[model samples]
Target: MMTLLSAPTSPYVRKVMVVAHETGQIDRIDPVFALANPTKANEELNNQNPLAKIPALVTEDGAIFDSRVICEYLDATTSTHPLFPRDGKTRWQALTQQALADGLLDAALSARYELLMRPEDKQWSGWRDAQLAKIERALDRMNTDIPDTLTIGAVGYGCALGYLDFRFPEVDWRAARPALADWFATFSERPSMQATLPRD
Candidate 1:
């Protein structure tokens, strides 16, 4: 079995978990909660991942960090249902979509950390606002480009939007993007998504 270093509140970790469920590889992963802080001394997580990030995977041979790499590895490992397309333009599209979704998550995470993790005196409103703007722009682009049907990109998008709902409800991302809200309604109903929905 592979050991998955994860934090329950991490959207990136949720992405990996959703992909694992979708690919029927959930049973192979053992979820291990981790707390990694640069200031914290003597943490083994730093050795496994020099960056000390969550969603790190420990396989038999070595460790893999970052949700994208782990999800792709899991998809490739399973022959039954591939979350990422094997070849051609579809693969490119999926990769691009995943990148967009990841970018949204990255911006959102930065905003969140600035508000929640950083000391009040150290918080930078300018940086937070910039990240929020990036997220809004990405959401707008996603609303325009959303596919009529579900695909790898759609799955990633769904997870990214779901994270916003879970962590930043005050932002009201849906009000301005009705189409995306509707699309997310359908996307969120998937069994894989339902199983991985974040909870308290």
Candidate 2:
């Protein structure tokens, strides 16, 4: 079995879990909870991943750090269901969607860290607002390009939006983005999304 080093609240970790479940590799992955913070630094995590990021996969061959690399590796391992398309156009669309989803997640995470991790006096309201603006722009673009079918990129986007709701419900993402809200409502019903939902 492969050991997955992950934080329960991390959107990146949740992405890998969602992919694993979607690709039918859930049973093969054993979840290992990790805290990626200055106070909770574990030497084992540093040894596996110098950056000390969550969602690292420890396989029989070696260890893989970062969610993108791990997700591709997992998708390649399975033959029956492919998370990434093999063709040129579809694959590019999926990859592009993944990038957009990642950007949204990055901005959201930055804002979250500013609020929760930094000291009250040290927190930068400007930086948090900038990140929030980026998230809003990304969400707007996503609403314009919302696909009829659920793809891998859509899964990633759904997970990213879900994380925002879980951690920062006060943001009220649904107010102006009714289309995205509807899409997310339907996306949330999937088994993969249900399985990887964030918990306190």
TM-score of each: 0.93, 0.94
lDDT (Cα, 0-100) at 102 in candidate 2 = 91
Per-residue lDDT of candidate 2, residues 105-138 (tens digit): 9898888888888989998899999999998899
Give, for candidate 1, the lowest lDDT window spanning 10 residues: 35-44
**lDDT (10s digit) by residue, model 1, range 145-176:** 88654456877898899999898888898898
The lDDT per prediction is 0.85, 0.86
lDDT over C-alpha atoms for residue 70 of model 1: 90
Model 2 regions more than 4 Å off: 38-40
Give me the overall lDDT of model 1. Answer: 0.85
Q: Candidate 2: deviation at residue 172, Å?
A: 1.7
For candidate 1, the clash count comes to 0
Give the TM-score comparing model 2 with the true structure, all chains together. Answer: 0.94
